[model samples]
Each structure stands twice: as C-alpha cells, then as structure tokens.
Target: MDLKRLNYFITIVNNKSYSKAAEKLHISQPSLSNAVKKLEHEVGAPLLERSTRKFALTDAGELLYTRATIMLSQMDIMNKEMKEVIVGGKGEVVLGIIDSLKTWLPKLIYNYKQSYPAMVFKLFDVLSVEHVKQTLQTYKSHAIITNQLIYEEDIDSIPLYKERLVAVLPQEHPLSKKTTLSLADLEQESFIISTEGFQTRIDIINAFKEEQLKLNIQFEIDRFETAVSLVRNHLGVTIVSENYVMEPIDKTVIRRPIDHPFLERTVYLAYMKNRHLPVAIQQFLQSVEEHFSTNKPL
Candidate 1:
C-alpha cells in the first residue's frame, strides 16, 4: 500500500530471508515481517512461501515483485533528479551502443565531458538491437546508437548516417581485384556471415530475401573481427560496415564497397518518443551529431 511496504517486500524477495532483509534495511526482523504482512494483506494474496530450507515467491508474489522492481527504480530516479536539481552542478547520462559504434563514441563522450566538466557518463556495450530498445524503455539508457533500427511506433529515430557495407575477401579471389562488388558477386563464393541472432545478420537476411537470394554461408561468426579474420585466412568472404574495417587490414585481404548494390544500412540515434532528455544528455547527443556531421568518414 505504501512505498515503505513495497520497499520492504522487494528487499525481502531479493534477499530471500526475513532476517537478512531486516539487517539490510536496518530494521528489526519483527518489523520487516509486519511490513511484508501488511503488503500481502493489501494485495489480497500470499506473496511468499517459505520452507524449512528455502524461500520462494508464489505466482502473485512474482508479479508483484516485477511491478515493485519497476516502481522502485522510478522512485530512485525521481530522488536522483530532485537531488541533482537542488545541487545544480552534477548530472548523469547512460548510453547503450552497438559494437560497431564503439570506435567513434569514445571520442564523442570525451568531448562531451570536456565541455560539461561535471556530467557523469555510463556506457553499456550491447550486441542486440532489441535489448537496446528494452534498455531505453526501462530507463536504463537515455539513448542508443546502432546501425540497425527497429521501427517502433513509440520511438523517435534521428538519422545519424548511412554506413557503406564492404566486402572482405581473400587476396587470390577473382573478384578481389574489383573496386566494388554487389551481392550477386557473392553468389559464386561461400560467405562467412554473421551469426543468426545479430542485428547485422538479420538485416543481411532480410535484404537478400527481398531480392530472392539466399546466401551460401561457409561459416557463421559472432564478431565482425572474427568474420574478417576468417576472410584474411582465405576462409570465406564477409560483408560488414566500413567503420569496422579501419586501417591495418590484413595483407591477405582486400576491402571493397558494396556498390552494385543493396541498400546501405542507416544508422540511427534512437530514444523514447515522449521522454524528456536532460540538459546534459541533450548536449551529449548534439555533440555526437556534430562529430559525425563534421567528420565525414569516406
């Protein structure tokens, strides 16, 4: 019923022991028990079941715990926002980024710090695009940058840039001499494609499916570097974003743009549609936009 009861319930559920929860909350065990009892009474269902050896949540308890976790997080955010507003000198922003963006985001984050000097940044390197979307919805990250975008109706996406997909091929491959190649050129070659769960792999699959083409995959890899390495060793050809294959590419390998051509993946800066970005976060976003605009990677 009250925030105190909800907090007590959550702590007890998380710790899974009345005595441990009481110690963590700095309250007496009896008080903790009474608070949990009051919560269960208000909800009209038993929240926890205890045996001699262990404790576990009932179905109702599981649902309540999930709801309470989200509520507690919102409360924590509200408290932090109030404290920051009162203090007037400190702020924090969390950014979830894909691995491909890691090469450029560090410099952008560093520039943001130089300008603000008091803002704190929390960066999470995420592999899944869906996970990035979930993170934004849960308020875990204020914004996300990724080459692949999921067209969610409730999310606002800003077009950062379109990155050209390039082919990494072994030195002796006949098409390696070309300046650019198309997906059709890959028909003769066995591809070293990204694994099925990756966003890039999904995009590649969908794009090929649209053209009624199926990839002849020799191997599937999880990381861009791994795929590229296989190509370097004359294993197979790979298609990846240009940013991922910067200088010092292997001597046995050659890179060429996909010009003959499929659609270039448009990278986006995505955030929740109705969310109010804090001043520091807005500044950081602006800085990222400016960086890409000014430094056109050819």
Candidate 2:
C-alpha cells in the first residue's frame, strides 16, 4: 500500500471533508477524491457512505481508520528513532504529569538528570486522565505519571503508589477540629472542587452521591493548590490527594482523612506499550521504578 494515499485517506477522515483536506494537503479536491477512489478500488470496498448528509465512514473505513492511525504512529516512531540514531541517539524526553506529583516529580527529574546531564526534559501538567492518555497516544509525551489507571491495549500502566483523598478546610472552620470528616458532615459548607473531567473531581462527586448528598459547590478550580488556597481563605472545603499536602504549615489550612467509604486513588506510571522509547525515557522509567519501590511516601 502506498503510504501517501494512506496519509491522504487519514487526513480526509480527520478533517471530515474532501475540500478541507485538500486545502490542508495542498492538493486539488479532484486529486484527493481520485486518490480515495483508487484506495477504495484497491481495497475492493467503499470506504465512505456518501448518501448521508454529514460525512460518515463505512464499516470498512472505520476499521481502516483505526488501523491506519496506528500504522502512522508506528511509522512516526520509526522515523524519530532513525533521526535520533543519525544524530548520535540523544533525544528529548517529554512527560505528562498530574498536579499531585508536583512535590516528587522535580526530585525525580533532578536525580535522573545527574546521570544524563545532556538529556533535555519537557513536562506538561494536565488535569484530566484522558488528556494524559491522549498525549501518549499522539506521541506528544513519552511517559505519564497520573492517578488514572488507563486500561487500553496500546498503553501500559505500572502501579507506583496509592494515596487517600482527604478534606481541606480553614483552620478556624467549625469542622476543622474534627479528627475525621465525612461528605455529609460538610453538607452546609460550600465545596471547592476541580472541574468535571478530572478523576479526583469525579471520585469526590461519586463519594457524595453514595451518601445521597450533593455538594454545594461554590468554586470549581483546575489545580489542587488553588483549591487549598481557597480553603485557607475559608471560601469552601476541598478534597485532595494526601500526596499533595506539602509541608511548612500554612497555619490556616487543615487536612483530615475522610471516613466511611474511604476515597483512595492509585498512581500509575504509564507509557506506550509497543513503541520504541528513547534511551533517556527508558532510563528515567527505570529510575522512577527503583526510586519509588523503596521510597513510596504513602
């Protein structure tokens, strides 16, 4: 199969319009249509359902799209590896991490860099587990440290650590003195939470729902630090991972474990399953495994 035609087909599917794909590919619409026709002739099946008002893929097209995407990704990885080899095999490592890893990620990077001083590191802090998975799938990130256990055929996840979710409140709040807290206990209090797509936010919402209670959300922030800061100002109470509780007391914020139907999440180090990873990425993964094996904080 011609890679160019395959690319053309993938581009058309992605854009969902022959004219748009032609514009993006710098080709005439007739040429693009001819290429797709040739592809269908070669495959012996129509790849699209043209009768539909909106662009739609036939069953064969759907299968080819999925396979073609994987093939293109593998080809891109091969080209990148070849380029790295041609340039003496040094490459940058990109990592996507959740906000809770802020405390330990820097230390891990610093220790890993000591051995490979020339290695370059790029980091992206994302809130949603799906975002991390998408980054790995698109080859935008080499690895991800996240709390979401992504179960996909093309991705592999390794258990790193488990931490409980706890409630954060202002020191002067009436419930702050309690040794333990429950979602029901905060029924009257306003809740500060992360946005909907975040796993922590979903988990917190589920926990509240289990008690047949709904949080009186007053604020929805993206980061845990922001939620903690809001808690300090007595804006509302928030729930966060235990790992995110940094030292050096804020003096105004208090953290307590939630009781009854304990909310806990497991952290995982995820990577592409069959892709050829750079040496720096492999080394960093190994270092992370070794470091966390004995030094798991929670």
Provide the TM-score for each candidate, comma-separated. 0.74, 0.83
Question: What would the per-residue lDDT of candidate 2 be over residues 1-298, giving only the tens digit for each residue?
Answer: 7789999999999999999999999999999999999999999899999998999999999999999989988898788767665554256788887777877878888888788877788887876777987888887888898888888999999999878898888888888778998778987788898887888888888888889987899999988889998888878998998878855547888888889564888889999988776666688898888877998563
Q: Considering only N, C-alpha and C atoms within 3 Å, which residue pairs clash in candidate 2? A: none
Residue 55, model 2, lDDT: 95
Best by lDDT: 2
Q: How far off is model 1, as Cα RMSD?
A: 4.4
Output the number of the TM-score-best candidate: 2
- lDDT of candidates 1 onward, in order: 0.78, 0.85
The collision pairs in model 1 are: none
lDDT of 1 by residue, 38-81 (tens): 88899999898865467889899999999989988888767755
Deviation of model 1 at 15, angstroms:
9.7
| Model 1 stretches with alpha carbons more than 4 Å out | 8-34, 42-70, 83-92, 102-107, 118-121, 246-248, 274-277, 290-298
- The TM-score between candidate 2 and the true structure equals 0.83
Candidate 2: misplaced stretches above 4 Å?
A: 34-67, 84-89, 209-213, 249-252, 296-298
How good is model 1 by TM-score?
0.74
